[model samples]
Target: MVAADGGTDRASALVTSAKFSEAAQRHNFEAGWLVRDPWRASTVSDHFRRLVANRLFVAL
Candidate 1:
């Protein structure tokens, strides 16, 4: 999840706590990208490009 606030620890903790079933069984749960607001167009584009390159987007 891309967060406007770059609080990776908080995001990680939230995801960690919300795990259930298959998610809970997986041990590799991790908070991925964290992008702050006031983003430039190039920066957003670059991030999306990288995510796509890495096959990170399941949709969009």
Candidate 2:
């Protein structure tokens, strides 16, 4: 259940629904935080670029 009082409902839903895979859960949780975190949004561009680069290298 979500900490509806002052917490993230969507994240709660994702958890309750068991949508998070074991290896990916931490990443998913962090992603949820990023979406809700304004500070994270401001700096995520660089992180996204690096992530894309890593993925591209893997794909190659």
Please give the CA lDDT of all the candidate structures: 0.45, 0.38
Q: Which runs of model 1 end up more than 4 angstroms from their true locations?
A: 1-39, 58-60
- The number of the candidate with the highest lDDT is 1
Q: Model 2, stretches more than 4 Å misplaced?
A: 1-31, 34-37, 56-60
What CA RMSD would you report for each candidate?
A: 8.1, 10.9
Tens-place lDDT per residue, model 1, 1-60, is 333333333222111234456765586454434333334433564566688889986535
- lDDT of candidate model 2 versus the reference: 0.38
Error of 1 at 1 (Å): 13
lDDT of 2 at 8: 32
lDDT by residue for model 2 (1-60), tens = 222212333321111333557766755543333243434443443454566688852322
TM-score of 1: 0.31
